[model samples]
Target: MKMSEAFATTIAGVAPVILLVAAVEIGNRKEALREGYHLIGQRQRLIDELYAAPEAPTGLQLQAVAAQTDQPMQSATRDLFIALYVMSALIVGVLLLLAESLALVWLAGSQRGSHPLQAAFCLLALVIGFAWVMLAPMLGLVVAVADDAVVVISGVSRLRRFYRDLDTHDRQQQAADGEQT
Candidate 1:
């Protein structure tokens, strides 16, 4: 049965309480979604730049290049774009998992009175769980997004810093070369 959002009083007025709790839960989840969307949008330009950059150098060359903060530039901006895209794709699986989970939850909820919760002794028991039919993806998404973001962000930050340092070094070298000649 599709419970009306009209607000019912059930389990000794617990329905309203459930509704209250549900509303709060939903709001909290919406906040999380906001944060997720924010996270998704914040680095868009950088991500696009990254998407266009070269594939990140691998193995010993990677370490050598990365450690060469004081060295002259080897890779071009084109290289950064290639590297960025490749690095960005490293987390593609995580985003795919998010998309799949959302689609599954949405589909399952749309089914006619299907019991999606199969686990025994679920937290929050019945009412809260019922309220969370739509929110099933929230906690999981936040967790997934948060966990993967750190490594990706740090890696990209390093790459960006490296790019800037080398670019600066190349420019200075060019100027010095021009002066010496």
Candidate 2:
């Protein structure tokens, strides 16, 4: 087989794998988001319970609640974010590989053909492939980074709220003890 044919075949073969991996990554991320949202709901419920009564909960109780709810939220968010990043990287890599393969194919085909029109077609394919490879990552990176930033910000906000609630309870307990004395 000619080098052009081999290169085209390789790109075609790899494209399916890229598509499959992207699909799986998207599914995993969706599931993680669902679980994370569930955990967020649980955490809200715990907060509501804490606020309903004046009595402060013990440190152990707070820790237990955090373990039950916060940990899972953190884990799911982290896993999903990492998976998304990896998926983006893989897509970028695949695009680059395809570009290289197309370039090779174009060069090989140009050398094999005598007709100017045939050579032009190969060159056009090469240019298109290169442009796509160069552009895809720029777009993908912007999207991935934006998503990661949003998740990180939301996670930090949740943690801050949790700790703030714990602090308020501790201060109330201190005030009550002083009144008793």
Residue range 54-85, candidate 1, lDDT tens digits? 88544765454345421112223223333333
* Highest lDDT model number: 2
lDDT tens readout by residue for model 2, 65-109: 777775655456454555555566465555545554554555555
For model 1 the TM-score comes to 0.29
Stretches of candidate 1 exceeding 4 Å from the true structure: 1-126
Q: List, in order, the clash count of every candidate structure.
A: 12, 0
Q: Rate the local accuracy (lDDT) of all candidates.
A: 0.43, 0.60
